[model samples]
Target: MNFSEIKLVVIDIDGTLLDNDRRLHPETMRVIEEVQKQGITVTLASGRTFISTARIARQLKIKAPIIAHGGAYIARVTDDEPLYEAPMDMNEARELVALLEASGYYVKVYIRDELYVQVVTEETLEFCSQHGIYYRVVGSGNLSELDKNPLKIVVIDTPQGINHVYKLLEPWKTKFNICRDTDRGVEIVKRNVNKGTAMEKVCAMLKVEKNQVMAFGNEGNDLDLIKNAGLGVAMGNAYAELKKYAAIVTRSNEDLGVAYVLEKYLLKNLN
Candidate 1:
């Protein structure tokens, strides 16, 4: 594909854009600004909350709409009401929480932008420490205690824990979107809420064609986004399952992979 046809750049946060320490590379930041000046829109799509994703966009100083909560939410870079949202059915969310707790896995419930847990466990702390997320302790048994429905739910444990939860939720897949977000984490959202679905809406709102989008991602949750984009870039650190679907594989996150490709292609356009 000719990279010059690209009009929108959709990026994932945790593994696609951020470094190992969860920070942006200066060169990456510079390249993004340059892309925007070239009339290309750079947007973020992540399993993270709208608040957290917005925080990253702010640091990048962008004002574009973002897909957050694994595509359960789409809004401008603010706390404003979403352009679109698909909250999980309350009963199903509670049931999944119960099943995960019964199986001895830690569950995180995301309502709008707030993260809640019965209590912070070692797994929760370790996961948050890696990404610098702040959460609240609900001090309850499960999501049954909350009257509000969540936009997304996350289960954290070993990679084996991912398979266990997948089997446990297999019957519920008809009602929710389930995918492994990391080696030790599985992300859940309402059915049809993955980034590919969200990207459709984003493309419409931005008035861009599917053949003009260039996306970058790293995890299993990113599968659909990678599959459907015009140019899907998988990081070298991405899983084999995801890499096979990429148009091309780039350097790893630690090596500023996203910026490397953009600078090469977008710069070529300049000269």
Candidate 2:
């Protein structure tokens, strides 16, 4: 493919841009700036909250819309208004909370744009700290205080515990979109929400075509975004399933894989 033909490059955080140590490589940021200088738009598509994603976007100096909440919400960094929001319905949120509670998994419910933890455990707190995420404690007795409207619900636990929660919620998969945000946790959003759908909205707003966009990712959740992009570049350390969906595969995140791919395919092709 001709990289010069590409107009937008959407990159995922975590495994795609940040190394396993959770730090963004300085080289990757430089390559992103190079691509922008070529008149190609660069944006972030992440499972992180808007607040978290915006911090990196600002550092990268990106002024475009961001696909956040695993594609459930898309908005520009300079504007608070969301171009699209696929929040989980109140009934669905309540039902999911009841089911997770019945299954005995300590979960965090995100409602009213706040993260509420059922019971703060050491592991959960560690996960939040490691990922630089913020949360508030709300014990079982305060479950009623969970926002009536929630964007999503997340269950944080060991891999085995999270697998158990997934099984327990299997019956409702058709009604909700369940995904593992990390090895230690799973996130549940509305069934219709996904990165691909959110990217499509951003493309429409920019008058860009799917054939003119490239995306990079390294997770199961990034599958749709990869499949939807004109050229899907997978990190070498990405899951095998996700790699299969990509048109090209580059080095692991720690090796500045995203930067390598952009330079080889996008930058090298530019005049």
Candidate 3:
């Protein structure tokens, strides 16, 4: 890939940028700043909600529009308004939320900037805390009364738990898209919405060509984003499915994979 021709670099937040422990390496931070100084646009793209993604964007001092809610919501870090959004059909969301609740899966729904939960588990609390997402308890009865459609619904649980819930939703596969956000969590969005579509929108807004973008990710949710980018990188710890689509595989996030690539591939070509 021609690094000099790239103008945008999209980084996934959880498994790709932060280590399993949820810590951002100093070397990673330093390299990000260095790349920005050289005139590349760096943005955070993830399955997180806007409120959650914005906190990390603030910490990184990124002014770019962030891709959140598994690419269903894209918003500027500085404002509440979205650059783009594709919410699930209200009836579909209500039906899926009900099914997940019936199956005893912990479900969180993103409605605009707010998050609503059917039940708060320890897993829910930890996820909210990790992403700085604030949520309120809204049982099934109250969910239907909400005025807006949900950006997406996330089921948080152990791998087996999520898998069990995933199986129960098999009938809806033709209607909604379901994918794993993490080993323990599953995200559901409208069929046509995903990171790649969102990336296409972002590229259009930025007036950059698809061949001028670079992306880093490590899971199924990141597949399309990786495929559409000019140069796609997979973290060393990436899922096997994702690694197949990446042009390069870097060190694990814990090992500063992001930093290593920036220095060797990105920054080296800036001069």
Q: Show model 1 residue runs off by greater than 4 Å.
A: 122-134
lDDT of 1 by residue, 1-271 (tens): 7778898999999888999888898999999988988888999999988877888888777777899988888999864789999998898888888888777777898888677888878876875665457778877575556789899998887888788888999999899999988888899999988998898889999899977999999998899999889999999999999999998899999999999889887667765
- Prediction 1 global C-alpha lDDT: 0.87
**CA error at residue 87 for candidate 1, angstroms:** 0.3
Using alpha carbons, what is the TM-score of model 3?
0.94
Ranking by lDDT: 1, 3, 2
Q: Tell how far residue 83 is off in model 2, in angstroms.
A: 1.9
List model 3 lDDT by residue over 1-271, tens digit each: 6789989999998888898898888878889999999999999889888888888888778988889988999989888689898888888788777767677666778887678876667876887777776788876546545667998888788898988877888888888888887788888898978898899899998898988999999888998899999899999999988899999999988888988998999898886
Name the 10 consecutive residues with the lowest summed lDDT in model 3: 138-147
**Residue pairs with backbone overlap in model 1:** none
Which of candidates 1 and 2 reaches a greater TM-score? 1
Higher-ranked by lDDT: 1 or 2: 1
Kindly give the number of clashing pairs for every candidate: 0, 0, 0
Worst ten-residue run, lDDT, model 2?
A: 141-150
> Which regions of candidate 2 deviate over 4 angstroms?
123-134, 141-145
